[model samples]
Target: MKVLVKLIFLLTMTTPAFAQADFKTEQLKFDRVSAAYEEKWNSLQEALRSAGIGRPFKLYMAAYKAEGKLELWLKTNGQKTHQLFRTYNFCAQSGILGPKVKEGDLQTPEGYYYLNVFNPKSSFHLSLGISYPNQVDRFRSGKEKPGGEIYIHGNCVTVGCIPLTDDKIREVYVLAVEAKNAGQDQIPVHIFPFKMTAGNLNTYLKQFPAHRAFWTNLQTGYAYFEKNHMIPVLSEKSGRYLFK
Candidate 1:
């Protein structure tokens, strides 16, 4: 009877992930990109595997080009939370952050969006789409089209989308799906500058002087999130962020 109980316990512990998502659609993405991103992905996997969040935690990045660099981070637990994880070069040919107001502008949009789906039929390999033309962007641009097609995809090349390389996106895509499956909804993405760490600020200060105001705004949001471990409802009072 004791032996039989041990066998059943082992089977239960080693049961297959039959109910978990099949991220086959995102394979072969994210082989490489920023070392920091890779490291974070591994750590996240280990954490989930250990915590057994009973599901994967969704990941999100708010990519921004400040001082000629592209940076990203991870957000989890639905759209209710976020955390700073890594930074990298813009790697975009066009140059800079903010919406691509017009074609060939070479700028990645800045603001709140969500990773809604994984696109296997992507020109840049696998792609995680951004819900662009968000209300804020719409009001900011005041343009009906304001263009779309933003993504965090494979292939380290960009016109208007982010390139995380085929290998890298594959990895990122899997992580993202895990995060969504874990969180139970679309992942919230808040694209912003390097979040202005003392070091980050000093590093890009020269290249992105115009971005100081933006980065400063992010500092407030970053500080609040860092303290609360939850994404605060940002309220604007005379162009200032007041946690709601």
Candidate 2:
């Protein structure tokens, strides 16, 4: 009787049914989004091919607050470098140029982050959550409140998040899902105050001296990618970003 009980437990734990249940959840999300975006999905594929990028390619995103643009970068499998894929404009903006420090500060965060969640049935149409209040933010904002729930979402409105139009977000969301399905995990999302050009940096420094050091550190990662077309491995030490 004990042997039979153990055998049944092993079977239940190792069966494919458990795995299929998780897969079905992801598939359902894809199907719902695909149903609403069949045409856009087709066009995205064509655009990818035209740009010489293939499906399931790794994706990197960079958002510039001053420019109000989100640039998508892609690299095909086995490639050593990424290429510019598309740029989406922000439909709305909020707060001023700075990192979000508190829960109600109304400031969009500025730093390196990743897409940590997907909202298929978002009230904003569809949303990609950004991993904000990251290591640096936590250290700077303290334990009491560092804010949360930052996202690159749709709805054309924002208090402390990046917003895109409903139609535009569908394209972004689809690309994110396809990349995840393709096994490119940890999609990097870098948010910058501006393009990080020499002139822009100098001007920003003049206007916001307090942020100069932080922005300077961010520029290191920015320059590394600009020169190599590859995302650098980043680490935090003493609340500062150390790019490897």
Candidate 3:
């Protein structure tokens, strides 16, 4: 009876570690993910070390549709600001510059989101799901069905999604897996129509006048991060985004 009790105590003490292990273990069960780790993990780890970021660091991602660029930012655990780590080009483009309004709009959404799913068996090699149609999107759509199933994926083909090509996604997927295994439950992903620099905004506003109001709202968040390199706390109010 004493030995049994001692064994149970040891298992209980290791529960959290086991929980973290389950995520990676299950992910590695997929062939593509295992291959990604085999191909990219060593180089990625070296890059992380050079950046002064270690395992369990936080990740923040941002994408610019017009520029066809995706940027990965990282910060060590307990750090407040994220530093730019790398940039990947979007291998394909979809709809014009604007927020996705309804199902089949073919417009990749623009707004605050997060990685909500990780699919190691993705048809496009591997993919990280984006949580779109959040409260703000629903509020804006009103009666329309805001489209769903957006992702940062591979394959270099898109109807209304960001595609980074198979080779690039392998690197990104590995980094995301490491971050998730480190206990990042909600990895932030912010998508914008374009880099919201004043010059770019002014130029685009003239060509796409209808999106002026919405883009202006997005600029506030962009400017905040541009100045601080920190994610801004945002709230949705009656179909509009308010940054705090």
Candidate 4:
């Protein structure tokens, strides 16, 4: 009987439901995180339900620098494509419309990345760190430091990070937590210098000719998402991004 009980306990511990619950349990231990749950979870869940998106959904975030917009996309119930869930405006903007190259360049990076860090006890209320200086960024930087530590955070202030107001961050942070707890790891966060419409691209290219090559490369990924409303499969080669 003791062996039987131990076997059941081990099985329970390894279940996906158990793992998901453990993730939320760890996050709620933080005071700010707890407060955010208290404030935003109910509404967030209700919004999801209203939109026909059920629990354990996948999340994708996209940020456009020129527009100061952050869009949240959701895919759930084994859906093939993502739907636009919400759009939030950045409370602050930093630098110009270009890819960040070296350290202290004061430019927000433009590329594909995923959320790799969650800071519940963040000094900026709450923050989700993006995987920057990716292979392509590294290749471009060469011998220089490509700069790092980019995040979508709160406090409405930034040098190179995307900042939403505290109230707004609460909503975003809670949604991210729920998605993570639902077993959707590697949440994607794509940043762009601007909406890559052909007109905009041509206009910006003339104004900032130096970034034409880089921006054109970025437009390929942008066009894919615009057409399919789906995440593009990306790979890096020779300091350039190739979208599949």
TM-score top scorer: 3
Candidate order by decreasing TM-score: 3, 4, 2, 1
lDDT of 4 by residue, 1-244 (tens): 9999999998987897787778889999999999999998898888989999877789999999999999999989488788999999999887888888899988888998999999987889899999998998999898999999888888977989999988999889888988898888889999998899999999888889999888899899889888998889988898898987
What TM value does model 2 have? 0.88
TM-scores, all candidates, are 0.62, 0.88, 0.94, 0.93
Candidate 3 pairs with clashing backbones: none
For candidate 3, what is the TM-score?
0.94
Model 2 C-alpha lDDT versus the unseen true structure: 0.86
Order the candidates by lDDT, highest first. 3, 4, 2, 1
Model 2 ranges off by over 4 Å: 1-32
lDDT of each: 0.59, 0.86, 0.92, 0.90
Please give the lDDT score at residue 219 for candidate 1.
Answer: 70
Q: What are the clash counts of all predictions, listed in order?
A: 19, 0, 0, 0
Worst 10-residue lDDT window for candidate 4 reads 12-21
* 1 against 3, candidate with superior lDDT: 3
Error of 2 at 73 (Å): 0.5
Which numbered prediction scores highest in lDDT against the true structure?
3
lDDT of 2 by residue, 80-112 (tens): 899999999999999898788889888899999
